[model samples]
Target: MFHIAICDDSEYDLQEISSALQGLRHLGICFDETWYQSGRALIDDIAEGEKSYHLLILDMLMDSINGIETAKAIRTYDVSMPILIVTSTVQYALAGYQVNAWRYLTKPVDPGELVREAAAVLKSQEKSDETCYVVQSNGTVIRRVPLADILYFESSLHTITLHTMREDIEFRGAIRDIDEQLTPLGFFRIHKSFVVNLSHVRRLSSRSLVMVNGDELDISRARIQQLRHALMDEAEREHISSHRMRS
Candidate 1:
């Protein structure tokens, strides 16, 4: 799914954009749209998100903030989002370069043009379905567990405990040893003794990373980037595909 955010002071203009988006739906585009009245409001929403906004449709002029400035600010957090600037005049089209505008549409933007641009954006966003990791335990009682089901792994005195959806699996191995095998599956060693699944992460704090199961794992400074990428929210398209397969 494409997460679209539109900021326009004039409700009429917002509706026009919304209608064009609905046109995409008429053509069978399944996505969601978020509306904002002004650039300031859009900035505030982006501030609260742990992940980057994917697409933004902005009106060039607002009383409080300019669309170009707003896009620049959003780019401060993430540079890859596709930004579409809407205006009656192309006066600020050149200014849009500051924010890496994907396209600039004039007032009375054609529904076909808007729909076409958005379709291209969505196509670019298409990613492979969610990936699952088949985790296997050692010894006579070997079991398989999906990576998404595991909350976090804890390293003990020469043994690792996998806190999972249904049960805890104990294996004779060191945290470092298990981490080597889990990294390819999106697991990160946040702390010296903890290997966590990014999908199950509830939140990441200065000292710990929280899991959906309410368990907290220690976070080491060295692993912050890896943890952030892992804990970031999954895309809607990805979320759907991830649930379709059981590992």
Candidate 2:
């Protein structure tokens, strides 16, 4: 199921688009929709990072800001998300082209076109590479481990232990410093003492992150979003693949 958003000021237009989008359900598509009355509201939502909609269906001419300008703001953070511009006529179509939009959808949209465009964008999200992380130990012997077999990372008074599904390694260092190195590798620092392997994460929330090994660790409130993207989403898919392959 692809998460989607239909943003338009006209209630009548939103209703029509919503109904048309629901029809995609028949074609094995499920949508998580949000109705934005204006492009300004949608842009603010993106800034807060709360409402993340994968596919955006925007009307070209809005009351406050136009869809073209609104898309530029969203592109600042999400350049890859597919944008489908719904315009009244082709005259306004060229304006949306500047944003590098996925498709120009004719206003009073066609059901067939909507379904096809949504499918194409959603299919592109799946990743082929499995992700892997190399965590270096700051000890007498320089050691690094594959992130997949890692259950979690624990920090004591002055040492951090890399807990794996098989074994645990103890190192004398700050977990904070190690976190910087693992940032690109998909390890999220859930707690001050723990930096979790997103791939090994099974269940997670604002309070805690549960590893595949069933070990529970506290989650920092500020890091909840990053942790969510890592574990529950495809954000961790490639990392898991690389680590598992190396093991």
- Which candidate should be chosen as best, given lDDT against the real structure? 2
Q: Estimate TM-scores for all models.
A: 0.55, 0.55
What lDDT does candidate 2 reach at residue 63?
83
**Model 2: lowest-lDDT 10 consecutive positions:** 135-144
* Tens-digit lDDT string for candidate 2 (1-247): 3467788889999999888887678878665778898988988877654555557899998887888989999887556567989999899888887888887988779988887887777665433112333333321112324455677779999977889887776767788876887766767788889987776777766698678888988888887887666665545476677899999
> On residues 1-247, what C-alpha lDDT tens digit does candidate 1 reach at each position?
4567889999999898998888888778787777899888788766644223346888898878888878888876555677888888877788887788888999898999999988877666543112332333342212335466777789888887889876786767778876897776767788888988776777778778778878777789888876676655443436777788743
**Candidate 2 has which clashing residue pairs, if any?**
130-238, 130-241, 130-242, 131-238, 131-239
